[model samples]
Target: MDANEDLSPRVMDANEDLSPRVGMEFDTLKDAWEFWLKFGRQMGFDARKHYINKNMNDEKITSKGFVCAKQGIRGPEKENMIRTRNQDDTRTNCPVKLYVSLVREIGKFKVIDFIEEHNHTLHLSETIYMMRSQRKISKVHARLIELASSSRIKPKATHKLMSREACGRTNLGFVELDQYNYLRTKQQKNLIYGQAICLLGYFQEQLTTNPSFQYAVQLDNVK
Candidate 1:
């Protein structure tokens, strides 16, 4: 058998079911990084940029990525509030990493390699809030909130429904309180803007249809 065939099986064994594959391509390094950042959050890890390759013009050409288990107090730390010599305060040394490269011919950045093994145990729940991306509301969730708001659902009720939905999903990594606040804030702004636009349109229609009617409003002056 040739060396290439022999090596292929070994590589497959190493990756196993956890084999990492290339994902979507992007036109810019910033876009690529943002995508991976969200992807990593979904996968229950924190993503970091290890390196960046740049051209003479200071343009990003390629990038390296790495992921580590969210760091926090270990099991032993939870048992004992006070620190001791035996309790290790250091973070886990997770080995998962990846490489991304820009294909100049295609004008896109692609994930080139991925090392999917981790050296430490990962938290099942708390990892969701470790990164900012994970805590933020998703576009789909935002749309759901908008729909609920349009239907005259109370913000608190909408929050409860969204929280229940999130709880049922194994992949979403968001805090219920945080998600509620985000949805509420967005809904308020959208409602205010929507009302203003509707009122403006009504006034314009009235003025256009009834030219003889003079509408006046008093304004409070403030320094």
Candidate 2:
């Protein structure tokens, strides 16, 4: 026999029927199959086919229309929670809902934009300082000197170091100039739109992404 035939397949622990390490966890046999369905997506296996094949091999389980579906109802009590919020409430409809939901998301974008703009400005200033120290002033020198006094940027430098920190020292460099201008313009527009949307109140979930059962908070609190 070939040496390859002697090698054993990786045997999972016999006592541990569900492989938690492989993202399969089960509180019971039914839960194990359910978990297997979800896990199949991650593992590149079709869980539905696996379940079907298993059912085919089992006489009792296959005798039912579908093992789990045959025995279980959708459960009446839980149905109301998943139902769409009433459309009659125009105050809580589509775009308004999206708008409300986006406030936090847009706010995050704003904070990030500020940091990026500030960093770019600081870098420009530093570059100007380095150029002046080296005394390699060129076209960029004229632009930086111009920017130092103008609202085209902001906070003009009275001295060399201040200019570096303020205008970010790209005398006439289009890349630096374009970025500063673009971000200032773009961010304003985005903020205005986001603010308007906020007034409408979209995406406001009564409950956060966390499981309802995980927290002690009441349903009204979630709302």
| Model 2 spans > 4 angstroms off | 1-180, 199-223
Error of 2 at 218 (Å): 32
Clashing pairs in 1: none
Q: What local distance difference test score does each model get?
A: 0.59, 0.30
Best by TM-score: 1
lDDT string for model 2 (1-64, tens) is 2333312212234463432232222233444444433332222222221122123443323210
What is candidate 2's CA lDDT for residue 108?
A: 17
Q: Tell me how far candidate 1 lies from the true structure as C-alpha RMSD in angstroms.
A: 13.5
Best by lDDT: 1
